[model samples]
Target: MKKLGRLEFFWAILIVITLFNTFLGEQFASTALVSVLVSITVMYKGLVVIDYFMELKHANKNLRWLMRLYFIIFPSMIIATVFF
Candidate 1:
């Protein structure tokens, strides 16, 4: 059995999360809790993509920070709007 590479591992994780979210969405109860869980998963997937898929892990510090900031700020805004 071949070991999965970093990119492959992240892809698998993202797929699993997406499937889980779909199932969770179908139930459609506890919107706040669901939203929070989805937001966290999205942030995790985004960071994984940014670092590995986007090849930003060893890129310029400024560029990496900018992308990280976008991921953090965008989800934070969505979560804030949902709760407040």
Candidate 2:
């Protein structure tokens, strides 16, 4: 057995989250709970990609914040659209 590096670990987590998202989408009806769960998962996935996959965890503060802000705002927008 070999050890997984940082990127590999994050990649694996993203894969798992993708699977969970798919299962959630397929196994349930469109309701507020489902929508909120999906949105939260989406935000987590986005942050993982932005911070780990994108190699922005140690980058410029402003640039990192800008990308992170997108993940936050977009997922919030999705939840908002679901309600109103």
Candidate with top lDDT is 2
| Candidate 2 residue runs with Cα over 4 Å from true position | 1-4
What would the TM-score be for candidate 1 when compared with the true structure?
0.85
lDDT per residue as tens, model 2, 1-84: 243487788788889988998898999988888888889999999999888778798998898999999999999987997877
Candidates in order have lDDT scores of: 0.84, 0.87
Q: How far is 43's C-alpha from truth in model 2 (Å)?
A: 0.8
Report the lDDT of model 1 for residue 38.
80
The number of residue pairs in model 1 that clash at the backbone is: 0
lDDT of 2: 0.87
What are the RMSDs of all candidates, in order? 2.3, 2.2
CA deviation > 4 Å runs, candidate 1: 1-4
